[model samples]
Target: MSDRWQEMTVFVRVADSGNLSRAARELNLSQPSVSRIIGALEARLGTTLLLRTTRSISLTEAGSLYLERARYLLAEMEEAEQAARGIDSLHGVVRLAMPVLYGTRAVIPALATFLPRHPELRVEIVMSDARQNLIADGVDIAIRLGVGLLDDSAFGARKLAFVERLVVAAPAYLLAFSAPDNPADLARHSCIVQHGLFGRESWRFTHDQTVTSVDVQAKLWINSAPGVLAAAVAGLGIALATRVMAGEELRTGQLIQLLQPYRLDPAEVYAVFPAGPRPSAKVRAVVDHLEVALNTPS
Candidate 1:
């Protein structure tokens, strides 16, 4: 690699690993050499990018901005090289961020065939339901499920699938408690809720130009999506769940769909990534595979 390329690569590694020794180990360089490279880069830029301390390392304002641009430029250069080499399947680690349940149930399973096709590629997955900082986290692609507005200038997003959500109950539960006739009737029944996403406080439903938000009585509040469905199957209470999450149960008659007359506000699933001129080959491949996999209903 060229001198500038080496500098940027080392800097990024240092920033990501958050330790000089670890970055040195990763780069196969001495710890003192890593420190010198960072120092020299700061001198060349005439500004400090990282503030290093004994306990932790943090990015300065300039460092954060620089890292974003550096990551983009590196990907672009790597893509150019691959194109010049006439390579079809690219080799590199593509770090992905996604929701836990979605990763387990959909994303991972969908990539089974596609992953084997690319023998040189490596995939690392970080799963969480919370919103992630794409650049700061070094995430190449993030699969998100929501209906909220997105910032156009900062990130790029592609619609993957329409998330079908609804209220559901166990056959046994409905035997004891009457099924909800409308959105408003949910307040009279017990509900199972998952934390860290929408519907924790209230569930929204729509019917022909009308929207209804119902405050549910949370008899059981859990953090896991699967746990929420399990609660409903156990006849604990009604659950607000995505059709994908409740597919098997709904099909097997373990859970009964409710509030059919009212339409639940569907969440839009997206493959979100940093805004750039173009996505790298690996990132695009994963996104394309997911787009096809998510759209094909199982």
Candidate 2:
């Protein structure tokens, strides 16, 4: 009898990657082992699946037919595996990726309550704004805030909330210089631009369903949110910042909102994970617990 399940997995990986070397790397197996599996699968079927060349590999007619069925079978097997392990009680380490500000303010605080419930569970958080591959990085979950989540492959994501951005300036700065009324007016002001992970300096705004992108060069440039907030509060210049990061300052009158009619693009925060893998009890619990915690303001 053919080892159909194992063969299907190897087939699916090779087809998706379109290269033996990448499939082997992703599977954490040697190239020879991958080749052997493919050879066995072709032998059982008594036909050539992949047409190999010195420089590249191409799928034959048989390979194309096999790939579709193989993917479905592999997906079904993964679902079954998840269903079999659906119980809530679990124990293991969960690697997490989160933006720095949220990691410090929201995620860490929620973990304090969650950790008690799962005494055997451990969490290692990689706090960064840069995106990384969850599987390659060994991450169980990633707390992301931005537009790149939709484009990611092999990941499942759930939106937590909308993160709005606002342009603000300290009271002293506003008194010294006029605040911008609209996107175009920003050009006359000294803007403090934040160069985030995506190398974005331009801000997006929407008015009456019409979107406009404003590129305001900054007199002062900063990479971190905390530094930007400080600079705005110290009357350095007008800063565009996330509502969550600048909430305290805005409430206390340290900074005043600018351009009320035009609003910046809102980013959604999501808890992302590997799509095929069933989350362990620890990961599931943390995701559930934090959703409630972050949604509720303390």
Best by lDDT: 1
Structural similarity to truth (TM-score) of each candidate = 0.86, 0.66
Residue-by-residue lDDT tens digits, candidate 2, 1-298: 1478877877776765567887797678899999999999899899999998877778899998887677557556645655676634345577788877757776798788778766666788888765665554656688887644456655666677766788899999988987777888877788897655323657778989989887776899776667778899999998877777788888999999988888777767788875333454466777888788878777
RMSD to the hidden true structure, all candidates: 2.9, 5.8
lDDT of 1 by residue, 179-250 (tens): 888888889999898875543668888898798888889888887677787899999999988888788889
Query: TM-score for model 2?
Result: 0.66
| lDDT agreement with native, every candidate | 0.82, 0.75
What's the lDDT for residue 126 in model 2?
88
